[model samples]
Target: MLQMLSSLLHHGSSVPENSPLPYTVKVSSRAKNARLKMTPHGGLVVVLPEGFNKKHLPALLQRHEAWIKQAAARIEVHRPEPLPLTENGLPYTIALHNSNEKWSVVYNNQGRRVLDVDDAGGRRLLLSADVADAELCRSQLLTWLKRQAHKHLIPSLGKLAAAQDFKYAEALVRLQHSRWGSCTSRQLITLNTKLLFLPDHLVRYIMIHELCHTVQMNHSKAFWALVSKHDPLWHTHNVEMKSAWKYVPAWVSAQS
Candidate 1:
């Protein structure tokens, strides 16, 4: 099955000061082995299968220390510079590339905390909040982003699945931190709201990737063969995904 860690522990926990790097542990019921995952933004995550002995973690880290340092350095070299933020700590414009929509955000201090799209076919957003209460504005904007993802991303995924004759139970959208998308063993697909920032082709690639997982739960040769059949450019898209985080706005990470 496509095992995914359901619980995260030691969120900001790190090894000793002299250790290689900071890391967190994740417990996965479906995991059959312990593995390490490194992401540019999430840093390092040590995933352990259920019933695994915690005492062995030290040994695992020691063995992987060389690989860890190399991977960390690679990420550091390719990490994109942070996006500049507006003076009010909010994005002046919201762009949903997947939907070919760009929204201009207008902040109005009408003494109320609310966000609404203008009548220009939803191209403009009117955010009414105390300009100083950036936190509230961000929360409201995030809620709106979820709605947009539901309106755009979910339907697009459904259409793609139908076109490819892929069977899936349901699809969901959330503000995920490290993952672009995931598919459960039960055939449910969860997409990150940050996808709204990606190009349309990449978004479709992620959808197809998850849909293929519904048929083949593991990334074996057969699974990749299936993906290749559906998305001929899966390899190119996969490489592009490694650096796609740059498309997302700084405010999105700030809210997280």
Candidate 2:
């Protein structure tokens, strides 16, 4: 992803003078080159290839300083407000908009650490853990969220693929930090569990986007054309996706 961002930069381009901004440096063995990524939460991240020259970082950052500031400002405009927290700093409810289901969370201190899906049609979650162990509760909640995603997202993707006559190997659900969904060369599709927080239409759009990747791996014009053939409103959904992270509860990423 960082490498993809670097391709947008103009090599040898002049940038205006600006104060150096605080940023984090991450070295990735998979990185073919150094790049800058401005995340909605993390302001600026400089991803460097392993063994890359540290001396070139100053010039590299300077060259991309303008882009970084602009990206940061854009992210700030769409940044989500923090979610409301309970006394134990956990969410009171888990809303899976994609599945059109909302589950109330009832935390119980039973001197045990476990989470149970209530038999009430799975509309309630019974969490048994030390209230003081917020991290444990959060982890349990995250695990539950992944299970929900697995139950819903995978089948939904399969249905969409079948309906559209698209073929794929398999679908999997995971908690991804930087992507909503991804498709591998072997046709395996992995969707982010956080996608459950998004609206149904947007979630469908993401699935379709990944499904399109099975045919066209890159974001070329032909790929988008294919997507348009299936989802005429994909453009609108794509624009809305820029700020869709706001729908995700804060606790989901609290420990991330």
Candidate 3:
């Protein structure tokens, strides 16, 4: 079994004893290219970059044993249960949790990890993990979501653009942790797949807002006018979007 180590900087504190990491870090040579990142808890992750030094990290961990112990203790006090899944190579997600939608989740063992819709009239929207490592399973699930965004958002963005009299150049939908929509000067508009979980009206407003960016890059007065033209009730939807983020499950996306 891979040995788990605690973090050195738990709770965002710089002090060594108060930290939440553990003693004796586990390292691999490939870890040189990667970084030692801490999860929301004290879980240690050694992200390996190219030319990693696997042999050196464990010795370093030994040198800092006392600090690691202190950090682990801190993690026990402040970390929440279910352990925020990021350490297991899977993060929590607040996705597709709509009461109106009929969806289910499961794990499946394919050559690679993936979350896919079994359009076979399958009642469950979620799939089972077909892989051994929890992290691999989550990577596959995220890849599935990315595919869904590309398939669904293109047409949706087009329709919304037309409704607002904006000519669309191109559209790309992605699974982003913090945004509903973003517009670029190149006429490239991106929508977050998470938008699907919002109330229908909010979804409509988000569409309209991004289409408006086709004409204006800034949130200027004319921009507001355009947004208001498409969505007079947009203010309400905007507030809902912010509040809705809280309900999303944890560790659903790539860690920053």
Candidate 4:
């Protein structure tokens, strides 16, 4: 009887299980108590409370099947609208980002990396004309972006690591599709290039949070305490990180 029931649960009860239920509710207990969650993973994940019995999980999932399907279908959101085309839509003869003391964009007609700060024009950046090819523009822009990351982020993480006496393996910037940052067991950290659009404070806070993972792998209280030691205002940064996408112009992803 148990084998038959297990088979039914995994394989769908012959075609009869296709019927839909009106509403489904997932009861997840991650910490000490069961907390309601609006959005679970692609299917559903009921995080059981500590010392919870695993035997009753099947029944719980079966009871909420309708709700799972409904929530999944209703809450799906397509990726945001792509950035509109440029005025002419012609591939840029060149696209550039100036990283001299500040950040700004440039267009066709510039040397590869000749940045001349002209004091004469109230301190404006002047690029040379030789490196003005399309490929060179993007390449230079990437290099400039990495340089920006190194300058703004590396030192901050270094200070955070020092405070905790944790040795970070490495820190790198990536063009990931969805993840913001991650910490490996080796203590190496990877940050999303989208972080460039995030405010510097939030970016630093994320770096600190990931670096702290060197000492603590999970989001347990100890891990958060580690983060708070370096950045007491981290909660504000966390909130800002949540809304960071809205502020990022579409061009950043396009360049990479």
lDDT of each: 0.81, 0.78, 0.56, 0.52
Question: Would you estimate the TM-scores of all the predictions?
Answer: 0.69, 0.71, 0.57, 0.49
lDDT of 3 by residue, 123-232 (tens): 44354555467666656666765665666667766766666678867787776755778878888777876655555676677778778887878888998888888899
Predicted structure with the largest TM-score when compared to the true one: 2
Rank by lDDT, highest first: 1, 2, 3, 4
Which numbered prediction scores highest in lDDT against the true structure? 1
Model 4 — TM-score against the truth? 0.49
**Candidate 2 accuracy as TM-score:** 0.71
lDDT of 4 by residue, 111-200 (tens): 445544344644333444344353454445455556566665666667767876778889877655456788889878877665665556
lDDT of 1 by residue, 40-139 (tens): 4567788899999988888888889998898788767765555445676788778777887878888888858888888567688898988788788899
TM-score of 3: 0.57
What is the C-alpha local distance difference test score of candidate 2? Answer: 0.78
Sort every candidate by TM-score, greatest first. 2, 1, 3, 4
Which has the better TM-score: candidate 1, or candidate 4?
1
Return whichever of 1 and 2 wins on lDDT. Answer: 1
Expressed as tens digits, the lDDT of each residue in 52-161 for candidate 2 is 99778888988887897887777667655555568867988776778878788888888488898885686898889987888888999899899999999898898999
CA displacement after TM-score superposition, residue 119 of candidate 1 (Å) = 3.6
Q: lDDT score of model 4?
A: 0.52
- Scanning candidate 1 in windows of ten residues, the lowest lDDT window is 1-10
